[model samples]
Target: MTVGTIRPGGRTARVRAAVLEAAADALVEGGFDRLDLADVARRAGAGKTTVYRRWGTAAGLVADLLADMAEQSSPRTDLGSLLEDLRANARLVQRTLTDPRQGALFRAVIVAAAGDARAAEALHRFYAVRIAEWSSCVDDAVARGELPGGTDGAEVIRAVSAPLYYRLMISKEPIDEAAADRAAEAATAAARAGVFVRSAGAVE
Candidate 1:
């Protein structure tokens, strides 16, 4: 398989993964302001038109890059218990952020997102995909009566990483096992306390 060929998704998804990986290299090597479409294309070994056609501007490219990230990442499958599932999610997030290459890639996106609408949109999609992946675990919890019927699985999943990201992006602290555990604890406690469940038994 090609460098970007063997990915965890479909054909289009594989191509996107290759592009994202190349874009990541460009971002890390050149920083936020120096990202060039040609460079990305060259790095990805993909045609420049393909890059521009698929993602539009640099911001758009960045956005799609994030979406690709969420896709390549393995979704959280049933792992017996909610807490265990959540722990798995936390660990995944922690590992990805801690990884030098992926971590820098995320930082690049965060910086690009500050002033770019396209990048911002892509970041949103990325989070949405990631959150949805783990939310199923919370849903399973409710179905199993491990959590209440009204529990908000999405919120529970988001909670697992909100603080973790906060520390990584803001305080620039480490996202170690302890931090992941803390995130899981706080979010789990809030989830158990009915923080995410809908009040009227309807989607909000």
Candidate 2:
């Protein structure tokens, strides 16, 4: 079903939900390269034609799945302090990346993004949405005089998750609450020191 054909809480929506869930399961179990439209349709109990008509390719399905994931992601926490808000963001990322199925699914998508241009665009958009969602914490902190003016809210939010992702994707180390706390603390310290402040006359 096309987007124009989809109505709220209708069969199209149900099919989309099922297909996206099945796509996530397939990615978690076998990675993106093994994601087949027919297999996903079978798993979702939808018609193969419907799946193909709605999402033409594996990349298309993955892109739609990423969009859905972004929409379903948790909202930012507001604890009246930059450090506490950052800690909440860090812990959320750490928890997601540490889960067995979710970790594998994210790794699969990251790997796919590395090799496919369309998937890469979708993955970047996913992070952009998430960062924008949490950036308000830094904005709120600045208003409260906790962080300096002109601090890059998006960059500060990214800093909170960067180390956790590094461990999950590169260092292959343990990603625990301690690691999350350390990331949050480091980002908070850096933000307090103006490390993420916007440069003057640099076009941001």
Candidate 3:
């Protein structure tokens, strides 16, 4: 269903989405540290009592917002081959980086997460969910003997796009198709080189 068509679970979920949508708008306009729940309530046209009753604090609101983001995110698809799958994943990240709304929202949340434990945990969960979803492609490759049996699916997934995020945040660089291709190539080469493969009894 489209975002506009989505009906939240109940009153709380509805209130929460409203609050988060307001916060997201503010995030795009400014940054997370500047986000005030009271302002959000005002912008959302939600009652202060309801907002406080549901979220308790600004951190709780941010955590809920992050959770909503993770839930709304697109699911990863397995396209029969690792190269194609990684390309799809790269393109997904590239699209996000290029998106006016999403990129600004992510940067705001990430910057706030640097100092807020709640935001940090929420952001961590967001990445963890995304990684697990895409890592299935790597796992499939190993299962098909395209990669070594002991390959680390999670690391391969992370290796592909960590630099994309780095460039987005650190250098404020544009993540173009060329960047996405390079990311996919680097990750694929590492997989080919067995960089993610775990040797037997490698727990040491």
- Candidate 1 on 44-160: residue-level lDDT in tens? 778899888887778877766676566577768678887778888888889888888778777888888887887888788888877887788898888887888878777788788
Candidate with more favorable, higher TM-score: 2 or 3: 2
Task: Write down the TM-score of every candidate.
Answer: 0.85, 0.95, 0.92
Model 2, 70-184: lDDT tens per residue?
8778888889899999999999999999988788888999999999999999999999999988999999999999999999999998898999989989999999999999999
Clashes in model 2: which pairs? none
The true-versus-predicted C-alpha distance at residue 52 of model 1, in Å, is 3.4
Per-residue alpha-carbon lDDT of candidate 3 for residues 1-204, written as tens digits (9 for 90 to 100): 012123658976676667788878887887876777788899988998887888887677778788777777888878898988998899899888778888888888888799899889988998889888889899899888789878888899999898889988998777998899889889998998899988788772
Candidate 3 accuracy as lDDT:
0.83
RMSD of candidate 1 to the truth, in angstroms, is: 3.2
User: By TM-score, highest first, what's the ranking?
Assistant: 2, 3, 1
Better of 1 and 3 by TM-score: 3
Return the lDDT, model 3, position 132. 89
* Segments of candidate 3 deviating more than 4 angstroms: 1-5, 8-10, 199-204
Ranking by lDDT: 2, 3, 1
The better-scoring model by lDDT among 1 and 2 is: 2
| lDDT, model 1, position 30 | 74
